[model samples]
Target: MLIDEVPERAVRRAGAAIELPEGLLVLDADSGEFGRMPKPVADAKIRGLSFDGARMVLVGGRGTCLLRLADGEQCWYGIPEERYDEHADLSPDGRTIAILTCDEENAIISLLDPETGRRRDIWSDPGTASHECEIRWSPAGRTIAATYMIWDDEMDDDALSTVVVDAADGRVLAGPFIRTHLLGGWLTADLLSFREEYDDLHRLQRLDTTTGEVITGPTIPGRVWAAVAGRHVHEVDELEDHHAEDTTFYTTDIGFADRRPLFTLQPKVEVRYFFLAAGVSLPPSR
Candidate 1:
């Protein structure tokens, strides 16, 4: 039994779930063949993907391309070698796929028309001028909030700015507040949530979309992360050392009661991660 003869196994599969014309991609953790779906197309190593009504937008180490699943003949590519996510959202009734990729200077946000393979720059600064680090659109589809990390070569200092803007015209409406780690999205239509400085506390906080006032949420201890499930917020507070972690613990409150152990995750491989992808509906603030 030679070491080379042992088939190379993927320790993990990290990406978003996207649909093809045939069927939805299967993503079962700790499984066979590089988290590939039953379909033959899943065999292609992809970094990220999002399917709109007419086209499938894909981004990976190779490049960003759009494929028309009809006859498997339609395809287009422009931006190459970058990472994207659901952040590269395909609008419900539109033909544009907007995605963000990191260039040397700032986070380059662009929109791609899968049909023509035309890439349009929505917001991006020329190398090292001012980096648009990240952008997240409101679930309502009317506003966009982004983190702009600014660097000064003259003084050798760094500044962080967060802003909410009109998704359509790109008009700045909110604060360019000094913040990072946008933990939650659209707590209210006029509010956004983020995490405080990791050293002081691991807690959830909110920023007023209009006035840019800081509002505090629940405070959990020890490098914690949270996800909103229906009516409750679930928290994952990690134990001492994350590496070589066997059993991972998490907690959540069922009702207006005590927060108890929601569950424990056992990792078969050395490298492991716990991710929660959820969508919660929030009412507009009055």
Candidate 2:
């Protein structure tokens, strides 16, 4: 089935907020209609959405603002003068927000209280030059995982790493694992799945935060987009015609068996990221 309501050029900036050139279109999944379209701010960029899809974080030339989708209420959080490429993720409960900010010499992770717009710096990489910082809260909101690409002067190439930190106090829990990138989902509250590259291949693996154990899972195809919830994998099917007017999204088991068509979009939307709604249950992997 094709969804004509979705604009062909609409980009999923983060969460349920679809990015248009002028502003954002909030999709109400339950109502099957577009919710209030928030007015565009100067150089507005959608950062992320709350777990329940009722609120979103937007950053622009002025600063960062938290917008409530139901009533258009806005909460402004001042932007740091030294920060560049700031990214934010709302906690599952929507009370706390994890913000990652990077500059030429350091990357800083901080916690923000949405109610009062107060912020506390939790973690910082003092001398490392880092960018593309992405942060996510664990399912239970007890920990946060941050993945970022760093300039590896020793290797003379860009490398990736993932770090897990205690959400309450920013205690380093498991990693700043080299060459590992979080796959955007946790298998369990303490078990995180990520993509590891070695021997010229990319493989899926899980890390145990409590016991510091690593479990290698499976080798992922080059075209796979992301491994979600440790159960299903989403990928672009290269076997299908790439130039078709409609684009199909497919999901497979963890092992890449039993592929199923999830949905098709007319006019072919170019998607860089996809997020599942909160509390959506997926079938067990075979």
Candidate 3:
């Protein structure tokens, strides 16, 4: 591994903020900061961020939109006025991007080229409702996993399901598995980690993707709020700053294909008043 470098300065710039959108973020690899772009909100909301290192894509309302960072000018490529409003992901080569699409009534998974801006609908599942969460891609770029839920009128509540799709043909590979709430998820070549939300508590589970088996027990406890995994570090949130003076190591894949941001995002907030406001929630004092 290359020598770890000092953390670079963070750039906190507000782009477009949309309601009920995914909180996906993109970062500049060199500066370890978010990509500077003009966020003009249309009918779409950006829910997740994925990259081939050089190119960044935002997935959310209205399908997957492409973002390119090259000669200092940030450019965006998108479908003209057609909205997809769900989770979107990119292939490993950065040539094709995928999205779980709907227009408040019909739903399908679509793919598009970032450079040419041409789109094709690959999979249409009419049974899929418009209420699914973010979509995740397998590390090999061959499959996609998404949360699927259906209402059983006899039970009177929604039953959750998870589905994995074959990227090549949009074939259902694994689930429709029952789950409660899926918060965030990531995939490795062999391992898959996911956070599940239950009531007010969050649980993290690690799974073996090949066998579709759980490797660790559920409901890991603590105030662990933030987590990002790589080959070098599995950084978890702690009450106190652990690496204040030390450099953080970032692992990289060859061919510059899979490059992640080298710096961790740190946000400092000052809360002036706590329990005085009516029905206002406050963060615990550090």
Best by TM-score: 2
Best-performing candidate as measured by lDDT: 2
TM-score of each: 0.56, 0.79, 0.58
Off by over 4 Å in 1: 1-58, 65-76, 80-87, 91-95, 102-106, 125-134, 152-161, 197-199, 221-235, 239-263, 268-286
Order of models, best TM-score first: 2, 3, 1
Task: Give the RMSD in angstroms, all C-alphas superposed, for model 3.
Answer: 11.0
Error of 3 at 222 (Å): 6.1
Candidate 3: residue 172 lDDT (0-100): 68
Q: Candidate 3 lDDT, tens digit per residue, 125-190? A: 433534445566665677776664455466677655456677778786665445533333443555
Per-residue lDDT over 110-215 for candidate 2, one digit per residue giving the tens place of the 0 to 100 score: 8889888888878876433233446778878999988876666777877777888998888898878777777755656677778764535557777888898988
Return the TM-score for candidate 3, rounded to 2 decimals.
0.58
- After TM-score superposition, what is the CA distance of residue 84 in candidate 2 from its true location, in Å? 3.1
Q: Candidate 1: which pairs clash? A: none
Candidate 1: residue 248 Cα off by (Å): 4.7
Tell me the deviation in Å of residue 150 in model 3: 3.3
